[model samples]
Target: MKTQSKKAMMIGTLALMLGTALAACGSNGNNGSSADNGAANIQSANGAKGADGAAGPNGGTAAGTDATASPDLSKHVKLTWAALGDPPKDFDAVKARLNEMTNKDLNADVDFVWIGWGDLDSKYPLMLMSGQNVDMIYTAGWLDYSGNAKKGAFTELTKDMLDRYAPNAEQKLPPEAWSNATVDGKIIAVPRNFLEYQDAGLAARGDIMEKAGLTTLSNLDDVETYLAAAKEADPKVVPFNTGASVGDYPLTSFVTRKKALVSVPGLPANMLQFDPLETKPQLTSSFDDPDLLAAYPKIRDMFLKGYINKNVLNNKTPSRDAFKAGQSALAAYGDNQFRDAYNDINAAHPDWRVSFQSFSPEGPFIKLAYDSGMMAIPSASENKERALLFMDKFFSDPNYYMLMIYGIEGKHWAYTADKSQIEVPAGSDPSLYPKWQYPWGFGDWVGFNKPSTTDYPDYAKHVEYMRSAAKDNPYANFKPNIDSIKNEIAALNNVFLKYGGALAYGAVDPDDALKKAAAELKAAGYDKVKAGIQKQLDAFTPGS
Candidate 1:
């Protein structure tokens, strides 16, 4: 695919600026003094100096040396890694510290490029099309990892290459993780080892639940009872605050064994639902599904009965903000969001405790593929070997990993009294020096240490619960080739954008909305896409 001229011009300008910065900082120098000396200093401090005078973590070889010596590509090469979100105010200081360790240990410098979430969809394609100088990039299934891999936007990381350059990553990550990262038998990216369960559920204000005499939220009926009690406690407070953009399908579909049909992210209007127990999976519409249709009217009745916010269809404010302000009693969220939501709500209302209950607490937990968050090498990289070395070090070395995730130890955060947990300093202003960390893109969850500030104290236990309970998606490995129906997918997506949210929110009559959506989908050639998907599914051999 050819790049747009405008994007090419922008990339050229960025490359020029980066080149100038590298030259001014003298980061390209080949002298091995800093790296060699730093390694020696660490060895002396740890008293791990070997008989050959080489120093390293395990006392095997010097910092950069191993059983297989790393290639001498340390000519001060600066690699750029792109990730989503804005850089912190003190990003430069953090980058400098990162360079200090990397330059010394791996003879490399890395520049992080932060792309705002809104701009990523547009920017990523441009960067790939232009063959931008970025060596490493953060990608995910949500970001169209499969599409990009198929389009040759990322380098295919062979097993031998990984063994040579990133052996730590290969060995530490689970075999299932590698399988998730593989596309057409080629590993296109390194999956971040952090595990998270994304089952959808409700978070309610504990104070409200207690005042209402509600003990636990086990099922939809229990949730309704809690919401009703919350309404009785505070007549002004909305029992449940929902928005047009947020889907209530998950909240209602919890009891059903059949999954709700929804558009796949990045692929847009192509929709599918699978029965986990079914040997031969088939795509079907939620609108036509009896269970989904039955659930919608009940939610709509709740909205009409003042149990849900009156302005839910038009409310633009996020549910978290509404809950924090005491405007809402309960909000729908994923299992992973509970801890963060609890912390945020408590920060605003210290007296108000927040509790989350998973809608799907039993077996059949949906296991997300490791490619949910990953770091991929761009095919345009000039320093692939050096990039791999840096990644290996980032995951293997605890000190380097910590620095990369959290900023300078004493500055951004400090250890608790016993040095068992991380915390902010007593008098430091957190606003001035924001702690910016991207755990998803960084490999090696084994190296990750959670800060004590997280509201869920039993996070490890929760992870274990999910591990033993959750079941993998039967069609996780299936990747449908949508090249033939691209235009139809786009058209169907446009139709969905116009009608899907309204149906999800129960903002319109279910029968009317469903008929309209179904008709439009058919007019947009949904059958062709369905046929295409079916063909791929038929050809797929389970566990092949």
Candidate 2:
């Protein structure tokens, strides 16, 4: 009787393991619908829906009681985590410290894989194709999230799995974030819970703004006035140095107004403009907009009047470099870029105070939550549950998150005398302890420590301002599946690469350039791609 009882217990344990394995590998059954045959439809809406997965053998329970229950400290597990960028020289040391904590708290260790920026495009795809033993990966819209999701490269983060392993994170993440992460009604990634307002504008020399007799630069006229002052002040300095490309600053009309659908690059046929005030959103070509058209001539005038660099069409020098070298007075900048510019300029030229000016009177522009950043579990991972558990700890536990981002507290960084902020110790060699400030890619922003007072005096105020005044894109959660129009998109990109920069910089005649680009786009099946986009837009119901 004793032997029989032991045999029954062993069989039940084996069954449970088998069941868990099967559940992890099962299909999510939410492959998004494909575009209908013919002109691909393009409509404007928000959000996609995903189907939930069936409960696993352990019966999805609360935080600690699920089938993949709280990790067993007695048994050890190791996971492979891949993040973008070059590995730090002290990576092994950091990993050793990280493992010490993880082993004690979660009974697991992580083998971090750093994919350098230059190698990501090639390496990531190969890993997915070869079904490498990678567990978690840093992914983002700009980093091919849509493409990888479509290819089943990432696991479907079902509600049950989330509840079982990352209940706190599931509840902490905003609804909009989940909506953005969903593809074909299945959540394929866990987006970081960070608030970032990427309002685009310009950074200029403070002396130039004062010399231009301008207190504020909120519009194109103000920008022109500032440029003129800088030119008059110094003949050697380009008033507005716009590097080799025309850049997105020229499309301030679209960006500042939030009229453009900021989809992943190479997907849209043209700059698809929309009216945020409209009850019903519609996609229109910026090339066809009269207001947008007017900006082209103005750009041309600036180019001709010598307000902008004459060699701007193919200038390889970065605007920041030009500023450092005293070759440029003004450069296009995003909100955070201004801070960096200020720091660099202040370090180099203490007498020259650098300041930033926003073009949009509407304040900061809020990007979609998912656009902030995300980490995803690969579909090929056998240790999905362990990975999810680690993610939860990374997001919810300040110690883990801080350790991963800033490194050892006393060694890599130290608190200020008042303990209100953190900073490197005096006389410490930074190279010995590299700080990877990639919170958006690894963990929740809510867990991040407050910035040191020395870094930004008004850090708290800035956060409050962004929370209160930043405007979200009305179409923030819209996800268009453009598999059918890939060929057309490729063709459009080629044409844009050849002629778009010239048009953007006013280096070419607008009328002739626009007509020729339009003609070529049509030949490349632009209309068909537009239709397909319209179809997805029409079918989409925001937050449905």
Candidate 3:
């Protein structure tokens, strides 16, 4: 979630490094701050109707119209939204508090539908394709946002709609956020304005480390040492309890340690690689990386030594949950996930010490793609205006935003005395009312975002380090139009799963599986896909 006060701080920090981002076209030839020109330009570009035309969805005035008049809040309406993850025990309380504001402001109430992590892959598309009653749903780059948008699953957002409904967000969000969310020249979702470093790492029990006399984990070898020690100390405990769905320790290690390769956006299974340092954007098959090949043996060794679970391919439980339940000694995931693990574990077992270590502590940090998290409305939604209006509160009102993110303050979490930081409240059981996994469409910077309070010291330190170390990714806004190579991408993805999955999981020797996988990928049209992506990359200008 993004907070209003933090905008200046983030902007100031980004100003020193992130130079001017690529502004969205039709942005009045500048940043998208001037609503007047932006709306008119969008009207021309989208061919939206003017004021005299039929009303837009939810009985709202047509786009490109004079929207100075306030919306009619006389009629009470109910909206249904779908967000990621399981709902907390105090969800009713949080929703009730949120509706109080919406009821008074927009005369609307909302029902939040929670979609668990496992269901997201199948359910997101089903909800859209089935024409469900969901007014809004959480979407992201990894969730096939462009694919869904192309399928007419989402509404095309115009600047007039934002200006009239979500004025605060329309004014505050940087141009890059909108530019990145644009698919085929239509803004499909509202991109979160928060700056995030989506780097990978592992969390370990600090208490165990102290007892074993182990040093801080700085690299892969250190992690292996800690895992081995933990395994020796307790043979029953799975040292690394991770699964195939999210990510693996091997890829995270190579990425941060080597600092040369990055996962291509929208291409999972490490099918394609991008080098941000390249003067011209480049994409190559991950199978060709020599460093990755060298690392496979190390991962295989860990698998053979019983440090990682042999049934990792079938493991469905999130690593964080396993870590908290005392099922594992090492929890491997992105750096951002450590906060939840720390919060839950500290709440349950006060004596336990949890800490996170980046595989590479310095260098090679790229900020997250702006569209990594977003709020999107389905084409079936009849309350489109109301949904936008509700989302607007997240940006316009800090209290509403805070309540949505942190829950009922004292009951769920509390701010420190100085109000500069957040911390768990006394006697609160974090597991009973977990932090909302989906921050929705906002990040703290745009006044739409996430906020968390942890008793763990390393939590705050990690955030500061990421903020200081973050670098601009030149291709952050470049979204490859995979529509042309959909068949090829699908085929290559299957090859990665059948062959690359085994190699990545350390189940097979790279010597045998790697060549077979490369051969299969070529037969599946890997070259055509790579060339198509490269062509798109060549046409992209970072700050155009």
Local accuracy of candidate 2 as per-residue lDDT tens digits, 298-343: 7677767887776654454545457667877865544433432354
The C-alpha local distance difference test score for the whole of candidate 2 amounts to 0.55
Tell me the TM-score of each prediction against the true structure: 0.72, 0.70, 0.81
- As a TM-score, model 2 comes out at 0.70
Error of 1 at 384 (Å): 4.7
Model 3 CA lDDT for position 60: 40
For candidate 1, lDDT tens digit of each residue in 1-544? 0111222112111111111100000011000011010011011111223334332212233244354756676488998887654566676887898888888987788888765422333576678768888888876654567877877888987655675687677656665566778877788888756443344456677787787677667655676677788888888887777542222223453444224222232363224545534577666655555766776776666666687765554454545446667777876554444543455456667776777665555535455555666788898988887888788776678777777656677887787788666666766544334433354554554444544454354544555565665555556676777888888976765565555444444455777777887888899998897788777777877655
Lowest-lDDT window of 10 residues in candidate 2?
21-30
Residue 76 in model 3: shift from native, Å? 3.8
Computed on alpha carbons, the lDDT of every model, listed in order, comes to 0.56, 0.55, 0.60
As a whole number from 0 to 100, the lDDT of residue 268 in candidate 1 is: 34
Displacement of residue 181 (Cα, Å) in model 2 is 1.3
- Residue 254 displacement (Å), model 1: 4.0
